[model samples]
Target: MRTLIRGMLEFLRMTVLLLFFMGIIGQLENSVVKMIIGREGYDGFRFGGNFMFLIGDLLLFMVFYRNYLQFRGWYTEEAERLPKRVTRMMLGFGFACILLPITIALIL
Candidate 1:
């Protein structure tokens, strides 16, 4: 049961990290594409953007997997209670994950 809980928490951590990185990569891709094509209003779906997301996410997955492997022993240990500060921070990021897309949509 402890391992199960720990795994779930670790999965949540990975997911949050994935979303954060994807957001950053996506913004960078948009900025670069806009600059290269010299179009300020090119905000529609494009094949290149899809390709970028696929490749960038795959690369990030590999990196995260490698990091997980490096710390596999720690992750497998018995789960313990999280400190209040850590819990708060995780909740904050979780809320950010929920709000970020809406904020971006409003901005763009």
Candidate 2:
């Protein structure tokens, strides 16, 4: 039962991770990238991409809200046993998330 709950929590966490990354991708590729490059106005590509991104980001934000609560220590990592390689990959991705905004700001 605990493992089941933990698995759900982990899923929530990863879903959050994926959403954040995709939000950045969507924001950059669909809109901000062109804005930074001095492109004016939206095209069909940006329109469709931003539309999808808005819907996806909204849904994912709702779903992963549980993990946000868990991040405050409402959930346990006691029985969490991830493979070292997986953990390393997660850590690396987390680092990338941390750095993304900074990198983008510097670039633009």
Candidate 3:
């Protein structure tokens, strides 16, 4: 159905955003840690990495907020006929969003 397809697409979009944000955070943390270890030898490069991460983080938050709004709009529009499976998928995505990164960070 159209709703199922839309839900899948939205889930994919959110997953991509989450991956992007995680990548940026990981890269920034690595860069800062390396710079700290190296003292002030590469301070200029440090700014570039930090700036990139900041931009990515900002964009990620914006996209996430927009997605949340859209989800709410869709739910409101289809409140009576919304599929239970769609709700489960959304909850599962949320749990993955929270747990996956923590697991990766801890393992790495």
Candidate 4:
């Protein structure tokens, strides 16, 4: 448990930056969509909606990278990679919170 906490702490910096950049990208995407559609609301993408989708893309990338690193046996010390596990859990939680709503919005 301590290791997990440590791993997460170590990974937090990168994650925070990624979230910030993703937010900007999300806002950008939303702006473009709003401009094209010339409106806002459910019919067009908003910052929060686009942010969730960007986060989904990031989560997919992280998952794939973790698997690739694990498979490649590139780590000198496996403990250093423990954060990847925590990030996976984070990804799951994020998807549940963000992606799920997006999905429901798309469907209904």
Candidate 5:
């Protein structure tokens, strides 16, 4: 029962994180594009939606990998630290969040 409850909580937490990421990235992208192109008649390709979708895909991968680890008995309360590669990916995502929107805005 405890494990089931914990799993549910983790799933909810990850879902919330995914939504937050999508919203933040989408809004930042929209704001940047509007600012760069003067909010005028610019109806070009929108990268923000693509990026948000990518975030969802990435979250799915994370959840699947976590489930695999749990099944293998590798994920436990004592092994709470995330892998370094995941941390780096998150850092890269953060950097891209700032850089990609500006680049896309300038290009469009």
Candidate 6:
């Protein structure tokens, strides 16, 4: 039961992290668009940057979703055998996802 709770917590943490990362990518795209518009007086940069950001966001979402699905249940013996660093990395990625958007928004 404790292991199950831990796994669920990890899954939630990962999902939140992924959402946060998506937000960061959005902010970055916004910044790039703002810059391009300010300097070049052209709208193409905004469109291209946004498009790329969308793609990246989608890809990250899929990856994180997959991870969530894979780990949603109780921890398996195999999962326990997995390196601690792998879990830490998953957590780190989630943290990055959350911060990136805020950072970009603030900078822009």
Off by over 4 Å in 1: 40-49, 68-108
| Residues 13-104 of candidate 1: C-alpha lDDT, one tens digit per residue | 76776777777766775676566554553354343445444554555454444444325533655434455565555555544543343344
Return the TM-score for each candidate structure: 0.51, 0.34, 0.38, 0.38, 0.50, 0.41
Model 3, residue 63: C-alpha shift (Å): 11
> Once superposed on the true structure, which residue ranges of model 2 sit more than 4 Å away at CA?
31-42, 46-108
For model 4, residues 1-108, the per-residue Cα lDDT tens digits are 766765675467446655775767567655654555455533543446655665665765566445544344323246234376687696786566455534555554
The 10 consecutive residues of candidate 5 with the worst lDDT sum are 66-75
Query: Over the stretch 24-52, how does candidate 5's per-residue lDDT look in tens digits?
Result: 75576567657776673225537774564
Whole-model lDDT, model 2: 0.51
- Candidate 3: segments with Cα more than 4 A from true spot: 38-108
User: Can you tell me which runs of candidate 5 are displaced by over 4 Å?
Assistant: 40-43, 46-79, 83-86, 93-105
Better of 4 and 5 by TM-score: 5
lDDT of each: 0.54, 0.51, 0.51, 0.56, 0.57, 0.54
Question: What is candidate 3's lDDT per residue for 7-104, written digit by digit as tens?
Answer: 77766766676677677766765665455454332243422444454454554454454545455543234424325565555545554543343344
Residues 1-108 of candidate 2: C-alpha lDDT, one tens digit per residue: 987887787778766766676767566554653555455333433224345445544444433343344355425665344555655555555445434543444464
Clashes of each: 0, 0, 0, 0, 0, 4
What value does the lDDT take at residue 97 in candidate 6?
A: 47
The candidate scoring highest on TM-score is 1
Maximum-lDDT candidate: 5
Candidate 1: 10-residue stretch with minimal lDDT:
97-106
Error of 4 at 97 (Å): 17
- Candidate 3 residue pairs in backbone clash: none
Off by over 4 Å in 6: 38-52, 60-108
